[model samples]
Target: MSTAVKNQLRVCLLSVQYNIMREMVNKVTFLTSVGFMVLNNAAILAQWFILLRLREDVGGYTMREIMLLWGLTAASFGLAHILFARAFSLPELIIGGKLDAYLVQPKNVLVSVITSSTSVSAIGDFLYGILLMGLCGLGLREWLLALLFTVTGTVIFTAFALLLGSVSFWFLRMDMLEGQVVMGMVSFATYPDGIFEGVSRYLLYFVVPVGMAVYDPVHVLVSFDAAMLLRVLGYAVLLTAVSAAAFYRGLRRYASGSLMGARV
Candidate 1:
């Protein structure tokens, strides 16, 4: 692509970013956010109620314990999006044909893409995540460990999401693939990682990357173990570096799906 063409695309994406930020202040965004918060956190609550009724039947967890876990996990769920929804939207940018515009932009495409979009719903998740973090039950040192792990978890989640999203450049159905993967991650996220073990635990922990978001961090926090903290922190940094490298490598292959470069 030519220089003038590239600059024009960056300018256009910047404009879109500004418009999105402006729209964030409106009533419509507020109401939609309220509705989704109700929906997203509903399952944990409903389960909490059901568990309370069946407390005698289920041997392991009490009503209060389940509720506490739900609240804790829910908060982490919120935190993940709050910190990295822009990166999470990488798949959408690819599928929505927005990437076609981004490719010609003079700025780094990843940076431009992030600036151009915001997941407004992330704010709701952020509020709840903070609540969970407080109650995860830790001494000052353990709390510090949890905070560190939470930050580490964010890095892992963002990197995992981006790696998955970047695959869309090669696959046509970016949204479908992204939705499936994200849904899988969400399904495992709030639930206690203790239920799965051996091979099952192995899958989530090392293979799929979902365990990074909740299980590993929660464990490290509860135990205040130095080794576990280092392990998770290492995964966070290493995975993030690997994922970013993968993204830029894929960016080089992005076709832009245009033969003539028509847009101004």
Candidate 2:
């Protein structure tokens, strides 16, 4: 790779390391927070277990598949928050004109903004996902697919959040709407694809991307179709491209808050 590219990667890594170290300073609080998050995520599985007992399957998903769904969703959610926590706060950053600091930085502004913070609890979510895969007794191929799906899902989640948060630059009072969209994606991701039909399915697959992020991954775990996997990957790439384009486009219109003047 070029020296410039390598330097960029190095800088990003340093930022992540520094953020993690900062979070680790409060050792007890960090550990408790992470542990509690894991327990809380695990507790959600109980409801699924109970629901599975009531019927042979929900939306054609067996208990095993449901476990994989939860694993993929939790892992992706964890990875997004842990790494791209600042992306979710884009509406706030944009509205408050906090992008000025990042604009003055040598690094990419979007990257700098998104990686500015780390969610310690998300580490627990990632670990739980790995544990869930083990519980699924997946073979090597299946395990690899799960990992690929998790990564793809993470990218989709982050890109979608960027897309939603970018809307703040164009319109007022979109903060609550942005939160609702993220929450909606998260809620739908945990459910079965069979539950949705017609336009809703298309929306999930293309518009909101919960399908590519979670539903499609579940399909891969069950069937292992190469074409379907490629489709999901293609969607992730397209979404990332679109989100990046939209964010930069909106950045041009961002108004500098008075806080920027106070920074000096």
Candidate 3:
């Protein structure tokens, strides 16, 4: 690898470690938050279990496939928040002039800003996803595929959020709209892909890109198609490039908040 690439990776790893340590300072509180989050996800998953009992499948997704869907979604969401929690806060940072703190750092501004925070509760989600995968009886090969899917899914989720949040650079007070769009993507991702048809299916595949993030992964897990896996990887690369470009392009229009603050 190139020196610059290695350096950037090192910075990212250090930022993640620091944020995790900061969150863990209050160990009891962190544990409680994680526990509650896992329970909450379990409660939501219970509804699916109940629904599946009444019917054989929903939209051609058997209970096993649905389990994979939820597993991937939770794992991806968890990974995104754990690593790039601040991506979701980009709009507020831009509007409130919080970017000044990150911009002053020697590291990549977007990377520094996003990695500055971690969601402790997301630990539960990550754990819960693994539990669900086990419950669904994923073998070693399936587990490896799921892991790859989770990473790609994380990339898609973080990139989409950053892309939406970047709108704050051009418009005023767009945080709510961006937030809703992201929530919509997350909400839609947990359901069976077969449920949506025609225009809605297209929107899932392209507009929100949940198909690439979650559905396609689920399909690959079920059938193991190389072409589909390549498409998923391709979309992740494309979205990452687009979001990073948008962030840097918007940086030119960024007006520093000049707010005094210490990161450490």
Predicted structure with the largest TM-score when compared to the true one: 3
Model 2 error, position 190 (Å) = 0.6
lDDT of 2 by residue, 1-264 (tens): 598788878887888788889999999999998888889989998888888899999899988898899889999999888888888878998888778888999878888889888889989998888788779989999988999988998899999899989999999778888889998999998899998999999998888899889897788888888899999999999999999999999999998888735432
In candidate 1, what are the lDDT values of residues 149-250, reduced to their tens digit?
556766676778788888877786776677677778768765666667799889888877766666666655544567776777778888888888878887
Candidate 2 Cα outliers beyond 4 Å, as residue runs: 260-264
The pairs that clash in candidate 2 are none
Model 1: CA > 4 A from native: 1-20, 35-43, 52-76, 95-97, 100-107, 135-139, 258-264
State every prediction's TM-score relative to the real structure.
0.75, 0.95, 0.96
- Clash counts for the predictions, in order: 2, 0, 0
93-161 per-residue lDDT for model 3 (tens digits): 999888887877787788888887888998899888878887988889999999999999999999999
Residue 24 Cα positional deviation in candidate 3, in Å, after optimal superposition: 1.3
